[model samples]
Target chain A: MTTAKSQRTVFFVSDRTGITAELLGKTLLTQFPGIEFLKRTFPFVDSVDKAKSVLAKIHDTAQKEDRPPIVFSTLINEEVRAALASDRALIIDLFADFIRRLETELGQESTHALGLSHGIGDELVYQKRMDALNYTLSHDDGMHTANYDRADVILVGVSRTGKTPTCLYLAMQYGICAANYPLTPDDFNELALPKPLQPQRAKLHGLTIQPERLAKIRHERKPESRYASLENCQGEIRAAEALLRQAHIPILDTSSMSIEEIAISILYGTGLIKRVKT
Target chain B: MTTAKSQRTVFFVSDRTGITAELLGKTLLTQFPGIEFLKRTFPFVDSVDKAKSVLAKIHDTAQKEDRPPIVFSTLINEEVRAALASDRALIIDLFADFIRRLETELGQESTHALGLSHGIGDELVYQKRMDALNYTLSHDDGMHTANYDRADVILVGVSRTGKTPTCLYLAMQYGICAANYPLTPDDFNELALPKPLQPQRAKLHGLTIQPERLAKIRHERKPESRYASLENCQGEIRAAEALLRQAHIPILDTSSMSIEEIAISILYGTGLIKRVKT
Candidate 1:
């Protein structure tokens, strides 16, 4: 008999904000979207009724289709676990995997601890940021760069090339003050580098996203305009890339890559440190 | 001998465009202000020397002081990492964590990846938002009071009380069709509910940020105007709360919580399925 027709989909459910799971999952799913990964997020499905809905979705989906859907669930409750377990699907429980490893490797109680959602890392990240800001305030006027001077690298790109988000993440995740800049029309036209950028030509890193995505972002603010026009964005992006190439600057296409992936690429490609997860 | 000060002071350095990190990090750092965290981002640290200046800041901080500073850098490449990871401080690499996890989990070597940038969730989040907007477009009326019939849960609050940000976040994060309307002077003067709001009081969730916080946020925009004045914000906030309390509607505070946290509260309070992160 032919294999049961399998409908593959990915779900991000979390007791807390499903951000971490969604984020982590996005990266993982990108590597396997052919499975028809349809992403659905259910936040705070803890109560019996809410939990029942989760069960019902799985049950109903299982009964209707030829093959069970590949269900990826992040549940922190035992009852919900029991309810969901009844479904005939390849369930990838986030906690189950991480917790098992933690218990096995660290000999520590992984329950409610290793949770990326409930992890101390979030708190640590928050505190670390506060201290960082205060420190920056005291060490103003570009002086703070001395310590971060270790940043053998910083990113320079146009307005929507995913620079800031990438940098903050780099800083927060690794304590890397990954600096970034936007190429203004002036800079793009003049093609003359800023004084600081001049000496760093060899060290310059650039990121470029798909023009369509950039336009999509710009549309939110000033809908229906040349600035937000696909053609304009594409032209500007293409021109910028050509200029960077001419300048002999190596650039990364941020179109398909996530911020995490981009950061790693810059680190490794540029001969940066041993890829350590900060 | 006294314990040697650890090079534990963390620093976040970025280029001038590093404003991205500052704004993103500002929100994150409020939770922890004691971590000796440092931020030094120069948009122009483009050269080897510029990068060196940044490195020196870290080196000097670590070397000059009894306590060595921990440099969390986001620059791309071995060049900066090599320069920055001097004898004085610990270099916490940001891009490495996600890459390592990705390589370990995905089994395939990762290309350039951006570890985790909080602001970058927009694209994925907005992907599902079209369904929400369309659903709301077809479902909502001006009064929007059909609590049970609402395309999604409704949010009501005084002006500048954070209804907008919360709703945008909900729409972005959970694919939840969230619509927000200020409980304006008219909402108060009429002392009667809007046509749409009256029917869906149960489905109508209320968001109340601390009056002081509301004042602070409004002040940033209006800057001393009556609308943004602390007195106005507090007054509006109080009256709005009175109305909601009178209606016996459940309320959530948006002041202390982040967009993520507030979204979670709504998902849980409304009994919506959380997107599990698997």
Candidate 2:
């Protein structure tokens, strides 16, 4: 080896939107090996000061090292771009570099082409899927549960019980159309499926959380609300469980499991669908 | 090997609150092999009907294939649990499955301890990153050239030139605060960096999109606007490139690239950062 692994350094920079960039960029980096990369996250794309500091560092490294340094920057502004353009090292501008090329090849005449999206499919499929989602989100009833009539499954739970995020995830990440609902204390006592739910009970599934877990989740938003109180939380949980048990409904306690686990379990138990990759 | 090469199946399910269930579920799935696992997603958990269908299917499958299924259900509802309690299969409930264990391990009363978050990291760091981005967007003062400060890099280009999207992508995806500004008609007419941007000329990088491509992009957004007309787009692109060339600014033509490719290129070129494993 030329030197100790620790001696080699690397950096990462981005504009105002830094979180998603890191998530995707970092995920993609796993393919490389051997060299040690030092990570520095840069947020904000509007400062000459930051660019100057980066430039000075680049110059310093150029004189001291035999091996060239690598810098990855996602420059979004021309001034910002001017602030860091240099010959000292390799620079990557995630947005500018790619967009220019994309414009040339795809924007030549506006074929009305839709770009690929992460609704997780290739461009065409992704567009179609997202279009479907937009329709569902906009046209679905106030419950946000229309065309859910076509759903292989539907989910219902209580407030802050992890419904919306899961539904969108299933639809986007795996292309599942999931609908959700919150159970009120009144529903627990009366016990036929809630009003709108009775008609769809055939596909209905419920997610219940521990009173403590529910309280913990609610506390983050409003610690003092009755919704987050231990006593109130416990009462609702117990009553709900009793009603569900008497009715013999299938349930999953979601206080601990992540979203993927829940979806997998349903697929296994219901035999609704499967991802083709695996 | 039972029927060699059978894919393992994973599902996500939730009733009441599929949000937490889905959020956690998708994150967990990222850990598995896509090629080896078949993932299915379901949302909205009402246990009664969904479970009955599941039971019937499992019964049919067992009677025919003589094998019970391996299912990872989130079963958040007590009713769902009670109903499926008799199933002869491997079953799991995410909530019931992990709560008590965590309580014992944490040595805290589950009821009072409620501040756990799903995402891992520091909130302050995230906030700082966001603050930088907001600052970059609000002010486009061109002081980056001379005593340029606080910018990793700047991007320059004409209006409708993919600056905003590119900048946002970089900031959100990479935590790289990228600032972008349009090369207004005035900049083209004057053919010089704005006063504020003049000092940081060395660090500035230019984005050049082909005229035809620019026209196409503008057309899609505003088919009838004068700016979207190909003739105008062509005129602006040619003039912008000339000005950039005169200033000796390094330029990237983003005409045909995916966001991933663009980001990777910037990271590679800038010598600012390196890749990381997910």
Candidate 3:
């Protein structure tokens, strides 16, 4: 039976966003990396018709493939969830399993509503996140230096080194007021921090990338320009690293890291307290 | 004993980003809303020294509080994990519990490594996400209309209705190429679809907000302007919703919704396929 299948199929089925299922499924599948898994997300599977269609797809895959498809679901509705379950596939209803256990343990029944997990249940928390996102956006790339005191962290990096996205992620996910300053070629000439950043050196976190990767990323943006050349990338990276080292500022290499990793690392290294809770 | 404390303290600790711990902890805590949770995150506690400090804080909180502090941790280092455990508090080691079960099920010993879950193990996936983010940022607020064909989803909403951040969230999280177009008063005069959106109606999703909420959000940015008046907001939203309803386009109210909730609802309502997986 093991030899019969070349790869297994996995589905993240949800009544709403399907993000929770995806995160949980991804974490579990990372453990069994040797076995390849084909993944798909089916969100808003709230209706009986949609649930039947999902079940049909699962049964079809089971018949054609040797291994039973693994399903990770967060459907809160009992009728819709019941329609999607079968002996033909290995279905794990995360909500149903955990909600029952939690209800018994807490001596209360769950609301079993759809789309509440990621909702704005608390208005104040939601507003704080929005305010942080706006602050991050307006202060991006050192657009306004007057509000430096309000920033929890300021990211300094060469352009296209995942600075903007990482700052935005930190703000959106954790209600962190993050602002990024681009380390321009002009700054490399002196290998000194910008005057605007001099007073706030304590809040500055640096990001650097591998020279080759930096060149490739720049090449995509401005192909055949001197700014995207390998030599230019190498020189800029070297100077930036030297400046960061000289200033005794901590830096992160983002060449092989995701935005989540970079944001978390900055939070960890800086000890910045999150403004809002998830 | 329960009445002794008005609020319970919860800590999400991790050796890496602490995002997974926070996410899992948030999900579990949502089940028990009766007890207020005062949550804090301590990320990248990889060393014994850091773990010791974390334990000391937990113990101190226990001493001062009427109830034991609850800690949800995802530390992978054996020694560091051991240092964080204390008899004075309730500690749940999420990684140790799951990794062992996964190892036994997969018939392979776990790596027990730190900061691996959010790593850029798949370079292609990372690049795709970066590309999507760039596309979303550049195409924000109908900046450039030439690349509308490249978008998987195009959000339509009146100004300040939260089209920009929602687009960014969709792109950054799911690698969906999301573009947002603002429905200016010029287009609302006829209560018809914008010219650029008519050709791609299937990819279009509408966002509307309550008039009072929209006025308040705009008032924060530009107070005492006609644009921030409740009458202007009510007129704009009424016209926008009429256009969307006339065309049978799916619409969502963003007044009380989070960005994640909006993105997921759009994906579900439109059946938009995610361009990248976690």
Candidate 4:
């Protein structure tokens, strides 16, 4: 072990996009905050030569640092995974272990496909998600208010409360037709449901943030303006909260939450079923 | 097992957002295409009461159905995770086994804290990602072409070729300042980079899709129109590919690829370092 160093080389290896491996590795690494990770992702490692090169790199790092580097891999191919399996370092095969357990439980052997998780495994679902993404983009900030009827969820929030990114994530990741309406100063004055959202109150999901945070976000976008002033932010948040409370709308505070957290919370709070598995 | 049906109830339980459990579970389930899973996510299960309810549900499902249900979990807290650990159903505790292995290798004990993965673990990185997302959104589809100087990567592709979503994903997920430009007939006719992009040629990454797939995608948006015609799609794709090749810009085929694949490919191909971890 390299007791003198606090940093370790970490590899997120995959046969396709290494996003899943990266996410899982990051989640695990977060538990050890005292250790620093110099991370790299090697995606599309679908060949024997590629796996050999990655193994060589791992061995080199281990020899140089006198510590084994961590490898978080999602390589699905048996041949490639077997080639990469070595005793030089800690190799975490995320897919192989789980797939074996699942295969046993279900009494069926898995396909062991290389890229099914993020590939076009189902064309219909992929098409639906793309369509939903387009719809969400077009309907952002109530651009097309008439399309509210087609939306599965309509997020209402003060400007910069993360309405747009949350809507995009829901649509792109979950295939949910999410439309976000920014609560403007005019809408906050009435403290009632906006005219466009009146009939579609069932789909309304309110997003809120701390006043100071909102002001700081706005200040970055527009410095020294009325819109970026703390007083304006406080008033808008107060009015928005009052409207949400009065209308019996569900609200989520996004000041310290990540997009994943916010999206999952909305799905649970609204009882919105996943249109696609991932 | 019920031979008459292919359905199974699945639970994603976690101490925090449950995103990791859901993602890992979904990836594993995709290998078994024959099974139809009705999935549910229970987030913020930090309390013993919450764990008891989840256990009760799992037990109830196992009794109701001839086969046991599947529960995928990433609960970090030992007490809460232990409460739900049972033999009534298949429990895939993602954190427990991996954390034990990681701890042994590092010669250290994990903090075992709850919700560190998606929480505000680093405020600076979170703010930087938010700022980058705003930048990408504002510069979407060649909006504010003058802002190209600030972009870490600018994606160029024909319309409806998965440019916008890829840009957004790169920015939101990795905190890379990504902007996209849609190539029109005018740019193709000129056979040159767009004037605004000429100065930033090093930052350009081109996206190309199969003509047939592009046609089908366009047809969905605008049916039977000239814009969606096969001939037009073919011509534009040919010209786009030629322009990218002649300009020495790397091109990615988005025909059967996913956004995650495209974004990671761009990052690797362009050598753009991620501004933040996912």
lDDT of each: 0.56, 0.53, 0.81, 0.87
B1-278: candidate 1 lDDT, tens digit per residue: 12332113445543223333333233233223233244443332334677787777777776676655544444434454455556655554433444444344333454332222322344555345544533443332334434336446777887755554455445534567777766776777755666767766666888898878887767766788888877778878888888888888888887756555676677766665443221
lDDT of 2 by residue, A1-278 (tens): 32233343444555443433344333223212333455555544347788778777776776786554555565545677788887766555444533343223222221211222221225554434333333333322226454556564677666665554445445544445566667777777675666666667667666788888788778866879988898888887777666656656678787765444465556545554542221
Error of 3 at B56 (Å): 6.2
Top lDDT hit: 4
For each prediction in turn, the share of the native Cα contacts (below 8 Å between chains A and B) that it retains comes to: 0.06, 0.00, 0.43, 0.69
Give me the displacement of residue A237 in model 2, in angstroms. 2.1
Any runs in candidate 1 off by more than 4 Å, and if so which? A1-13, A18-42, A45-71, A76-90, A111-124, A127-155, A159-182, A188-191, A194-205, A208-251, A255-278, B1-205, B210-236, B243-251, B255-258, B264-278
Clashing pairs in 4: none
Winning candidate number (TM-score)? 4
DockQ of 4: 0.66
For each candidate in turn, the interface RMSD (Å) is: 10.4, 17.1, 3.6, 2.0
Residue-level lDDT of model 4, residues B1-278, one tens digit each, is 32343888999998888878888889889888778898878998998889999999999989998678999999888889889988988998888888999999987788898878877668877777777888998999999988888889999989988899899888878788889999899998777887888898889999999999989888987999999999999999999989888899999998888887888888886767653344
Which prediction has more favorable lDDT, 1 or 3?
3
The DockQ-derived docking category for candidate 3 is acceptable
lDDT of 3: 0.81
CA lDDT of A216 in candidate 4?
90
Q: What lDDT tens digits, residue by residue, belong to model 3 across residues B93-180?
A: 6666556654554455656656666767577776788889899989999978778989888998899988998998988887888999
Q: Order of candidates by TM-score, top first?
A: 4, 3, 1, 2
Tens digit per residue, CA lDDT, model 1, A1-278: 22333235555666556665565455444433223455666666655577668767766666776556555556656666666675466565655544343233222342342133323336556445433323322232223444444444567777767665455445444454465556766667665654456666655787887999889867864799888889988988887887677777889988755555576567656654343223
TM-score winner between 3 and 4, please give it: 4
State how far residue A223 of model 3 sits from its true place (Å): 3.0
Which residue pairs collide in model 3, if any? none
Model 4, position A16, has a per-residue lDDT of 86
